[model samples]
Structure formats: C-alpha cells, structure tokens
Target: MKLQGTMLVKENELYIGGVSCKELREKYQTPLYVFDEDLVRNNCREYVKHFRVNKENNRVAYAGKAFLPIYMCKLINEEGLCLDVVSGGELYTAYKAQFPMEKILFHGNNKTIEEIKMGVELGVGRFVVDNYYELELLEKICEEKGEKQAVYFRITPGIEAHTHEYIKTGQIDSKFGFTLSNGELYNALEKLNNYKNIELVGIHAHIGSQIFEVEPYLDEVKIMMNLVKEIKESYNIDIKEVDLGGGMGVYYTEEDKPKTIKKFCEAIIEKTEEVCKKIDIKVPILIIEPGRSIVANGGSTIYTVGAMKHIKGIRTYVSVDGGMTDNIRPSLYQAGYECAIANKIGEKRKNQVTISGKCCESGDILITDTNIMDIKSGDILIISSTGAYGYSMASNYNKITKPAVVSVQNGKSKLICKRQSYEDLFKLEVV
Candidate 1:
C-alpha cells in the first residue's frame, strides 16, 4: 500500500501531521505508536460521504477491538460514528469517554451475566446476540430489569472468504455465530419468538478480515436476503436492521489491492437493493463495523534498531528493543509489513537483512527478508499499516513493557496513552 495522508516523511524526518517522529520518540521513548488524528477523521468522513450519496439508512460503527482509547472513542463520537464494543472493559472505556450509551452496540461471543446486566442497565442501542446462551442471559436480564432490550441475532452465513483461517470468523465450522447450514437459524427465530423481554429486531453476519474481494460479501448478502425472506414468511416478522459486519481489507504491502470505502459500501448497497427488490422486502438499515480499514493505515509504530549481527553467509539479524510483545501480527498470522528508515527515507536499499525482536524465542523475527540500505545501531525504523492491531494485541511477554501511543494533528503531537512501566506491570500481579 502506498503511504498517503499525514503519516509520511517530510524534510528527511518521519512526520505525522507535520510533527517529527524523532522528537516524539525522544519525548515518549522507543517503541511508540503515533497516530495522525486528521487521517482518522478523514477516514470516517469518507465512509460517511459514501453512505450518504444515495440517502441510504446506514450507520458506521467503529470497531473498538481494533484500537480503543478514550481519545479515539471521543474522536469517533465527534465524527458521528457509532461505537462497537466487544467486552465490558471496552464498554466501560466508551462510557468513561462519555460516548452516548444509546449509540453503543455491544457485541461478543460469550458475554458474562454481569456484562448483560450492565448493558441492559445502561440501555445500549443494541446487542448482537451471538449464541442461544447469550439470548437466554439477555432474556433473564431484561425480564429482571423490566425493560425490553433490542437485539440482533448473529448468524453464520456459511460463506467463508479467502483469508487467514485464524481471522476468518463467518465460516460454518467457526465457534462464533449459529451456522445456517443445519436449520439452526430457523430454530433460533422460533426461540426468539417466545421471548417477550428481548426484542429481536435484526440479523448480523461478519465474514472475515483483510478480504480484498467483494464477491464473498455479495454472496453473504444473497444468503442474508433469502434468510430475511424466510423469517418474514415463517414467523411473520419484519426485520428492522441488517448488520453486515466489517471485513473490508486495507493495504498492508505492495501486493494488497483494497477497494475504497465508498466503492465497497456502494457495491453492498446495490446488492442489497437488488435482493430486496427480488424478495419484495424493504431494505433494512445498513450497519457496518469497520475496525481495521478505518485505522490500519492511520498509525505507525517506531522502533530503534539496537544490535546488528552478520553470521557470514547465513543471514543478517537486526534486532530492535521491542519485538513480538508490541506487534504480534507477524508471528501470529505470518503478516507482512513494510518499513523505512525514519531519517533516510530516500536512501538506496543495498543491504538484505531480517528484522528481529529482542526476545528469547527463535520465532521473534519481525520481517523475514527486507531490502534496505545500510543499517546501524540507534537508527529509527518505522513500520507501516500497524494502527489497527499493533497496540491492541500488545503483551507483557519477556517482562517487556508496552509502548506508548501519541496523536499527531496539525503539526502538534500529544500523548494519548502512556507507556507501561515496571511498576505498572506488577500492579496486577498477586503474591
């Protein structure tokens, strides 16, 4: 993916919204996450603009699991985008940010009883019910609270997109939603019909992440449209919303070809309109939970190269202070990333090296084969397309502290989340 927006080099220094990455690193230390606020706002605006072109009843909910912070939550709220929270901690973070509870949509595969009660008490906008157990919990909570909770049944459309099996969630054999192949969805509708406290208003499906092709989405829409028809006919119910969960891919490397947000949304709308016309059903409100596409390219991670070792003809190892602890996508999904020297963006790539992290395991390699120019100690390296899962999946492995996150906008940088310290790491440890 080509680097665009505010995160680019300017005057031989890595600049994010006109702020120098070197200066931010000096202030925040190595292994820091820097985000361009303007880029994120622009992304949301792009989604809003495309969805508003045809006056479609739609809502763009920022998936908080991608990267959640009080500032990020507030920014999404300011842009008029709803929030999609997976756990109680995420819900609490949104609440602390003072995001409107009515605009929050709670989503999770296995929610605790207390979580359901909290959601019910907070009066969230909707809950995407994953399984029958969650439905039962919601029923009990809603009945006890004496309030009818609005919900959407999460269904597995049984359409598996071509993506990493670990990240593919919408397959028939997945552990998430109820599969549509064995008549389980029909049975779910029947069960929902008997519940008076929970109001089943819609259906939800999320195929997978990092999907470049749109055919999988079109196929899912077809199955969902048919299911909508079946539900309306058999149960005599009118679904109010159809949530197509987000899996829109973003450019990670030069090989990735991602569609623009506008094009992707337009295609889905066209398909929905076509299916609705055929089934004689009105188009429901379109809700998309885009997490990665919205922020994956908006942020970058900076690490300082420490030790450089060349084992004759074997391989060159360039180790950084932080490794799989901060960004595990490489080791987790065999993900690919592109990087450049912060101080020398236009330098010639003459050296072939492998980027390694300062960890004890042999699987701590960040980049297998990278072609870059001369490398040395204390050189700053910036990785592209890491704004989504880099910080969110960070761990305390090897007793390494997590990195800090800062926001850059209009040539100014501000610390949004502080780096973890040794004391902070032991705060949760019990004797």
Candidate 2:
C-alpha cells in the first residue's frame, strides 16, 4: 500500500507529520492507533474537488461505522462533509459532537421505535429506510408528531460485487434492502407515497464494501434509474436525489488495486446523467457514504512485541500485546494486512513469521505468514491501512484494555482518545 500525505517511514521508524512513531508509542504506550489528520483532510478535499469538478449536487457523507468518536465527527464537520450514522449509538456520538442535525443522515436495517422517534425529533437530513417495518414505524412516528420526514427507499440492486461475503450487503438475498425480483419495492413506494407524513425524496442502493471495480456501481445506477422512472410514472413522485452508497475500495495489500475517488465519482456522474437523460428525468442530487475509502489508509496501529517463539520446520510466532480486542478485521473477514517493524523499518527481510496477538483463543491471529526483518522481543510492529475498522470494532476481550488514539499533523501529535483503563472494564459490572 502507498503511504501518502503526512504519514511516512523514515530511518527505520514510522513518522506522521514529522513526528516519529517511536515518540508516539513512547507517549501513548503500545497497542496505539495513530491518525494523520492532514491525510484525512486531504482525502476530504480530494472527494470534494472531484465532485465540484463534475458540477454535481453532491454530499460526501462520512460513514461513521468505520471509526467514530466525537472528535472525528467534529473533524468531518470541519471538512464540510455530512455524517452517515448506522445505529443509535453512532447518532448519539454525532449528537455529542454537536454535529449539525440538518447534515446527519440516519441509516439502518432494523431501527427501533425510539430510534425513529429520535430521528424525527432531531429533524435529521434524511432517513434511508431499509425495510417495511422501519417504514411503518417512521410513518407512525412522523404522523403522531405531525412532522414531514424526508426518506429514501433502500433497494437491493442485486449486483453482487467482488468482496467478502460477510461484508456484502447489496445482493437480492441479503438482509438489507427491498429486493428487485419481487414487487415489494414498488408496493413499498406506493405505500410511502400515500402516507401523509412521509415524503419519499429519493432511492438508495449499496452494492457492497471493499469493492474495486466500477461495473457494480454502473449496474446499480441502471437499476436505481429504472426504479426512479417507475416511481415517477406510477405515483408522479419527483425524486430529488439518488444515493449510490459508498463502497469504493482502498489498497490493503500489494495485490489490491483500487480506482481513485475522483475517477469513481466521475464514472458515477457520467452513468447517472446518461441514465437520467434516457429516462427523461432530471438528474437528482448524488450522495456518497464513504467510510473506509476515506480513512482506512490514513491510519495505522502500533503494537509492542511481547514474545518471539521459533518452531523448527513450522513458523515463528511473533506475539504483540494486543490482539482481536484492538482489531477484529482479521478475525471477522480473514482480512489481510501488511506490517513493518517501527524500530527496524529499513532492515532486510531475514525471517518469515506469523504475527499473533496476546489472546487466549487460537483464532486471535493478526497476520499469517508475513515476511519480517529481525523481529525480536521489545520491537514495535506497526500495522498499516488500519484506519477504518481497527479501533471502531475494538473490544475488551480477555479484559484487555483498548489503546489510545492520537492524531498527528504538521510535526505535532495530540491525543484524541485516551487509552482504556482497567477500572473502565469493571465500571458497568454488577456484583
């Protein structure tokens, strides 16, 4: 993976914005997540620049599930990007960050009544309604509260993109959206049109995550355009927007090649304009919810080597202080990652080993079969391209406290999140 912007490796040490990784590890201790603030801002600018060049009424909504904290919300808000929250906790985090309610887009498959009511009360920018039950609950809440809610119908375009099955969400048989094979989508649109409180303003579709190709999005736009035509013809509903949910892939390994965000956006705009022209409908506003693509490559995880074990004719096990508790991607999706010893960055590859975490389970492996150079106890290992789901999916597994997070920019580093303490784990426990 290409390490761009302020995050770089210098003199056998990782550096972010002129600050060395060794310095960060020293201050924050091992098992740390360090984000390059300048890199993230640059990424945001790249997206906005491309969208502006296309002259599309576009909104870059930061997908908060990747890594969300009150500080992140503020950073995204400062960059002028909207927020896409999937659960009540995410929404609350945005709220705590004092993010503008008008720029928040609520999304989820199964939203509880309280969540629906919360959205209604907060007057969110839009709600991406996933199922019939959620639609019903939204209508009920809006009706009782005498409010008009802007909603987008989430549809399964059935275009299966090449990605992990556990992360794929856009297939026909998936649990997320209204399937296209059945008339369920049409029926739901009809029902939504008749509802007094619901205003169906757009259509939303997400093919999958970690997608590298453009064909899936091209296919999705076609399906959504057809649905838009049907909705206009049947109900005379003038859809104002079409959200092609974000799944643009980023480089995780040497073999993975992903298109630039600018190129991806241009393709989407071209296809959307073509489809809308063909259907004789106005081009709707384009919204993207990019989570990993924006931030995944902008951060890295730092861990201190705890032990090293060599087995003859088998493999060497290099263990770190943190395991699945800090990063669940490997365990969840069998995700592949690349790492370099922070203290020995320029050394030649002298050993082949598997990086293991300090956890009880056998499955708590971080990287399997990785090439290393002179790994030893007390060396610092830095995992790259972990900015997305690493810290967000962290747990207190085996009662291991989560690590601290620091944002580096312009030769300076500031702590954004504090390391979890042992007392934090027992605070919620009952006697």
Candidate 3:
C-alpha cells in the first residue's frame, strides 16, 4: 500500500531501485526475496546519524539474524556499522566476509561450546552473556585460549514491552537474561569477578522485539541506569557500555504507526544523557542491535499468483507458489503485510483476496483479507517489508525449495543468495 525505499509506481508498474518488479519476477522467478541496497544503506546511515557518537564510545550493530548473507554482511561493514551475531552461522558468515572481528558482538541463550569457541577464536569483540553458565563457559574458553574477552551481562528488566507475547524478552520470566528483580543479577556480577579472563565492560537489556513506543525504551534506560548506579554503589565498578537490544517496529501495514528513528534516537540519547547526569555517571557506550527496523521495509517478497478460490460471501483465496517456507512471520507472530499485483498496479481495485502460501499447513497464510487489483494466474504479487526474517528463518518445509534473494540499487540488481534447488532440500541428509 505504501511505497518505501526505492519503491515507486511508474505507469502503474511497481518499480524498486528503478527496476521493474515484473522484470525481477521474470528474471528471478516468483517467491523471490528482493532487498533494496540503497534503502539498507540509507537505513544504516539514518540509524547511524541519530545514534552517532565518537567511534570509541558509541556503536550500532546491525543484528545480522534479520537477513544475513555474506554480501549483506559486506554491506554492513561497508556502511560502517557493527555486526551483532547470535549463532555460529551468523558469526561465521561475518567471519568469512572478513568483517572486522572487533565489531562483532555475540549473543544467544544457549550458545554451544563450539560456537563460543568459534567466536573467541575469531576474536569477536564481545559476548552479550545471557546466563551464568555461558559466563562461566566463556570465561573458561577464554582462559583456555589465553585471551581476554569483553562481555556484557544481559539483564532482564522485567518490562513487558507491548508486543507479541512470543517476542518479549525483557520480562522477568523470560529465558533470556538474568532478572534484575531477583538477586541473581548481583550474584552473576559478583561471580564474574572470579573470572579473570572476562572483562565485564557493561550490561545489555532488550525489552522485546517489534516494539513501537519510546517510553518503554526510556523506562528501560532509567531502570538499567538505576541498576548501574546501584552496582556502582555496591561494587564500586563503572559500566562502560549499555547495549539496548534493538526492537524498533517498522511499517508492516497501513494502521501500524511506528515511531520515527530520529525521534526514537533523540529520546534515547536525551534520556540516557539525562539519567547519566542525574546519577553522576559517565555516559557509557550505548549499543542498539537494530535488525527489523533497518532491513524489514527495505525488502519485499515477489510471488506469482496461482489458483484463486472464492468462498461465496466469505473470502477470496489467492494461492502463491511460496508460503510458510519462505516467510513464517505471519503465522508465527500474526504478522501483517500489504501486497499488490506487481504486474497490474494502477488498475481499479475491485477485489478483496486472502493470499495463501503453498505450504501444506493450514496456518500458512501470508496476507489475510487484503484488497488487490484483479488477480490472475501468472500475476506477480509483491509483498512488502519481508527483509528482516523472511530468508533468515526460511525452511524446506514440504520440501519446497527456497527462493533466491536479489539486491536492487540505482535500477541495477544483483543476486545475493541463490535459490535452493531440490537437491538442497536433502543435501545433508543420509540414508
């Protein structure tokens, strides 16, 4: 419904990066993932501007879990943003891309020992320690490696960020981090002192994902600041950085009004500075791991219309070749999206249709009850804002092959990820 990034409708045809969507569909085939290079770069630039500071004390790590490929990692490195990785694959992608190891921060709740080994071996900058086990394990690994690793203890601030229940991380009962309300946070910090190899530089807190309000983040800052002040009074140690995990919501539908990045950044910086001033503590390096907001709306999924089913007085079902295998956010988080007939844009919109993925599961719907122009077989259906987790979380469900990913910039396009062939579905399988 809304044109974003390089998206424009010329002569009623949807064009992204000055390239035609129909052309992309023809060249790359349907169920394609399209990322706008300039948009991603612009998002990085805009996010950097608002969150900018001297390189020594401030940084923005693009959460690579959103949509990570070697090329995109290269883009992130080129754009001068740090990379936040949560798994070995993500970290390995960064490593293989020759991403500056000093700019990578590792995170995960249940990171395998091998993953930890890989990160430490690759000289990752820091690890957002999730639990005591990871802290102890990482410390031992660092000791074994004869190296010092900086770390930030993840603190659960017990704030229920108003978002989907599945995505909330800062709540007290979450499986993420040490709960601030409990004594374990202090215990964890106190225990950290014994690990000589771990230099606990700061604390990290992520209230939740897909969050829209700034007040929650402001609350988180104040809460974390209070904790930092108390830690200072109790332990006489200073926190040098505070990584607020990114969850700035973006436009998924017309009714979703996400806060502007500028306003959000301003509020965060002003509040952090204000709190630091009030607490008489130095403003630490503020880190935000933005994944969805930075890349979500900058990408779209192109699917071809197949069969149409209309239940009398119910809804029209337009099946696309791709579904739950490519993008599962709709079913996983009840996510919403806006789609249009890429080849038939600028036409009179008279039909309301529900888009269905070809997945065998009944819950494999993409857009529910959307209004599109007349749809027909072979029509290109361009779904918006799928850059974040579409490809990253894709699967081979029903043995459906995954689509290729293309990055478009300045009317030029380049393939970033190759489509999975049927062989890819069972490449690693053994009889």
Cα-based TM-score, every candidate:
0.97, 0.97, 0.98
Q: Pick the candidate with the highest lDDT.
A: 3
| Candidate 2 lDDT by residue in tens digits, 8-61 | 678777687789988988888989998988888888888887765245558888
Model 2, position 228: C-alpha lDDT score: 80
What are the per-model C-alpha RMSD values against the true structure?
Answer: 1.3, 1.3, 1.2
lDDT of 1 by residue, 1-431 (tens): 25657866677677888887788878888899889788889999998877652366588889999999899999999898999999999999998999999988899999999888889888799999998899888898788889998888899988879999899988889888878898887888888767899888889999999999999999988888888888889998888888889989998888899999989988988999999999888888888889999889998888999999999988999998888999999999899988878877767888888999998989998888788867889988888788999999999999999999998889888999999989998898998
Clashes, model 2: 0
Q: State the displacement of the C-alpha of residue 399, model 2, in Å, after optimal TM-score superposition.
A: 0.8
Candidate 3 per-residue C-alpha lDDT over 273-362 given as tens digits, one digit per residue, 9 for 90 to 100: 899899898788899999999999999999988998889999989999999999999999899999888887889888899999998899
Error of 1 at 49 (Å): 1.4
In TM-score terms, candidate 2 sits at: 0.97
